[model samples]
Target chain A: MKRRRRFHIQPKHLFLILLAICVLLIASTSYNTFMTHSIQGGFSTVLLPFQKGMNRLGGLVYGKIGSIKELYGVMEENQKLQEEIGELRRENTRYQLQLKELATYKELLKITDEYPDYDMVGAHIISKNSGNWFSTFKIDKGSRDGFSVGMNILADGGLAGIITSVEAHTSTVTSIIDDGRSVAAMAASSGAPCMVTGNRLLLQEGKLDVTHIDKDDDIDLSYKIVTSNTSSEYLPGLLIGYISDIDKDTNNLTKTGKLVPAVNFSRLDTVMVITTLKRTEG
Target chain B: MRKPVFYACVIAAAFLLQNNLFAAIPLIQTTPNILLVVTFVTAFIAGPKDGMLVGFFSGLLLDAFFGGSVGFYAMIYMAIGYVNGFCGNYFYRDFVTAPVLLSVLSDLAFGILVYFFGFLLRGRLAFMDYFISIIIPEVVYTALITCVVYKPLLKLEERALESSKRSAKRFV
Candidate 1:
């Protein structure tokens, strides 16, 4: 069979063979939606107990390491806070201090008031998606208590992926890193919008591309990109991250930018899920 | 006839362990190429035809489980077994460093094949991130397991042959 390579495949013949096989596999596996779900469910049930047990074991080990690392961040932050406190004490400007407090209070109130209807159940992450799970994670809570599929998950910064699958005790948060996820986001600065995709293939270029950007648009670095509230699976104003780079279409109205997700996803340990944010309009 | 059944049992047992027991090991982030490792080792130990068949079946099972194109696993694994068998006939089976090196290489090759085909299906995706974010970590995890897993699996292999249970032969 060893000979000089010939690159030609008779296209019609090859196409037929491929089509025939696809039909065969589909016929074999696709009994019905219910049947498919049941089979997947059966396999998932077998896997879930294993996944949960491993998650707990890994959580214990990582938790200790995380606490140590957190302790170090806390000490560092405390020293910085102490310095700030000293400055506040020295200035003793009651009027300015009150202004700062008032602004922060207003912001916090707005966030709470906007979502007063939803109950918040906070969760601590126990384990990453083992290998290649930079895009998905497991939280220590699940459905029997109240969580369900398609719940909006967020942390201090922005929207996480929806809960694709939920067990009695845990839910899988598919991250923007998941190949299956995409978000419609816009530049907070330029008002230009584009699709923010989470496929890891862009990591090869060291960053993701927000394509179809307008060359004439005011695209700049650090332009805040948030989920476009109008037509997103995410609630409005949840920060995904800022644009670290801008690819302006000088010739068109649309602009695209590189997203640097706000959350330090590498060490994400805790997350907040908004269980009840729904549109009351039409 | 007996050898085929024996090999089939070994492959099934490996799949069961991969889906079940291997999860208990901590910080082992590699994509336990349970099927890949078994197919390669079996091809190395048995011969080309048996190894290739085993690998194809294992790959088929992997495809069914992981939600990808069906024959993709078979294509890569059968190649692995075929090549491993080709090498087996010539190379010393006792080379201590060989398993580690061979595993890393095969997984990488398998990963690249996955990426190449995945790219064709889904356009304009990140190849390096998939490699760096997913594949490399999995390879390292798989490589590390070789050290711990090989010793025990080898002993079991010896015991399996010694016991010769399936053949109605008494344990020697």
Candidate 2:
């Protein structure tokens, strides 16, 4: 008779197997292979309904609590806003006159408008990433809603982020405040180019790093910064933020500064996604 | 089989709370890592095998939801679970200090691992700033939440184990 052998499984073997599996998953996901996409898509589709229900329930509960808290401060806030509105109305009249003059100038120069009207869809934020390391969040709109990767998201009347991933019913957005993200921006007045980079540490102060500005650039504090025309992904002329401070770099060739982002990232609820992709020349 | 199902449900619930309810609460500056707490509690009660399994699945859930790469969290959490399981010999159902302490350390480990992979690997060498700002606050928050979370999870694990043992005895 042939000798019978039995297979034995140990904890060491299990650990090695798990390690291998994790490595494989990391590799596959990094490459963004079809298998990884399908798996993520499948899981997202299954979880979408439950997540939506949870989101609504959480919103209702939080809304009740927030309203109660707001009751205490509403009167004061209303008075302050009334004064602000009066000031803004005066400012608006002056801006209207300036705009008319600018329009006349544009007509004389025969210059085309830089800002294009974009087709957009509004989306509600469903949930945010659990950890503080990344400022990515999921929104209710997805591929079904005509959202695709790299579509610019606008919130609070400025550029918020770009769509990074999309499933059937939900999509993920990496906000401008996230680490490692950079936007090509320019001073609205002088058109001097700079790079606005995200830093989580600076996020506590509601600022991002504005760097790579030429030493001779005339950009100064409180200057309005908008997206540059040369940006590969973002449509040009969307508002980014204002320059808060500028400093001479040690290298003397470039200057660095800080910017206050236009969007209030802490309370992003609803955002508009520009559905048009930036046209690229081949 | 029943035990696995129970743990899976618990992990799923923690995942939802971490991403949704806790995240929405404006009172807290940073949301606690409840899934990490669950992993630590599981590893503290159960042996390395169960700990590793729970950690792997929970980490995978996080990866599926938000991770750019699928297995970064999975590997870190699995190692945490396996290491914490070695402390099971000192575990008692009523005691809370060990679990609380271990959770803090594990959270720190998680933060450091994230910093290493997410920042350092990308040539962002600002470790001191990250440690001071992001890592410390998260560790403190997760530890405080652990005090509230540990007892309930221990009770669930005990009940599941007792039922499993009873079923096994019946088979014999």
Candidate 3:
């Protein structure tokens, strides 16, 4: 009788394959928090030049499109701007005096003075997650530039996001608006503490949800919200947003409202990463 | 026409374009998943093994760029590519339906997995809201991109395959 022919993957190969997958899964889960920084950095190093070239090309295309759109509106915009410029110049002098006075007061009070060495590195927003807009974005600066996880990112306006992952020459920023965790915030007026959280349902309307406000707190609509002193990750007093549309919870204990994020996440081009690590001395 | 080198170049270009060029185009609210489309196209043109290989590398590229974990996207893309590759046998070269349908299904899978892992596990229980708002629109957008990109990629694959055959004949 002829020997029976068999076609099957050996058990040893199957075990090896499963083992490899398990190892990869474990490694990836820890990648952001702990392990694999060097490996991730290496990948970023390879991708840096390509990313830079592509970013330049993207900017060119965007500029052309913008210029074409501007052509039709230029005349009307010019007229409006010309009329406003004269009035704005007068207001600017008055504002400059007030700003100088406020700066003197801030210096006297030692506000934001704790971190005297606070410095920032500027980076261009190179890429965004296509599926989720600003949920995660790549910056041109990274670990090589002294960036690390948990550092705060700010845009022209205010607190843009936080650095969650760092590579060699690139880092990924998860903006405060994306649906994930919440940030501890305090009302600039009443000192009432709250939580600013990303909500997808609310984000379509260009807003985020603020929770944990005391029901009886006289929180005014449009009151400025800033990072709370109690916040472990974010530094105190960074502007978060302005609160609006407060509603009491069914339990009548806490209030929830909407906040208009300070950073216009869609138009973000340049961002500055606050390299100062939150003082862990407490 | 060197298969490995060609595939590598194509995947890298696709990754860059997907993240930067197409991402900047605000014509659509949600950017189309060009890398995902490329992975499926490779599977549709090549067989399962090649599809899996391409899918793994493309997913790895994505993960390397922005993924929270290194293997999350790679595993998902590999699974999608392998399954799509089985559909290759029934694929007619000129037909557009296969890619469109495959894109929709694969995107749906991606959305479910992402939501499950990223949100639900993290105690964000608003499944219906995310599914309708983000997941559905993304699936539609990705499918639309498939309609435009399918033809060129198919042509490229045909040319590459023919050239490789000629080279192989010469070698023999």
Candidate number achieving the greatest TM-score relative to the actual structure: 2
Q: Per-residue CA lDDT of candidate 3, range B1-172, in tens? A: 7888888988989888888776665544677777788888988888666677788788777766677677677777777777788788986868899789989998998888878877788787888888888888889889998999899999998788788777766755
CAPRI band for model 1: incorrect
lDDT of 1 at A212: 56
> Residues A1-282, candidate 3, lDDT per residue (tens digit)?
332234555433433464477357647567444555655677778877887888788878988898888897997799899999999998999999999999999887665423345687788988877765237889988887999899999885478889988887789898998886589999987888999999776887889999888988867699999889899899888888888788889998998899998888777889988888887687
Best prediction by DockQ? 2
Best by lDDT: 2
lDDT of 1 by residue, A161-223 (tens): 667556666666777756536776767666776677775655434345565555655557877
TM-score value, chain A, candidate 3: 0.76
Superposed model 1: Cα runs more than 4 Å off: A1-36, A63-114, A117-149, A165-173, A188-191, A201-208, A213-219, A230-232, A250-253, A269-282, B1-35, B46-89, B125-141, B164-167, B170-172
- In candidate 1, position A91 carries an lDDT of 70
How do all models score by TM-score?
0.65, 0.87, 0.84
Off by over 4 Å in 3: A1-23, A26-28, A31-34, A73-117, B26-28, B166-172
Error of 1 at B32 (Å): 7.0
Error of 3 at A78 (Å): 10
Ranking by DockQ: 2, 3, 1
Runs of candidate 2 exceeding 4 Å displacement: A1-8, A67-116
What's the CA RMSD for each of the models?
A: 9.0, 5.7, 5.6
State in Å the error of residue B148, model 3.
Answer: 1.5
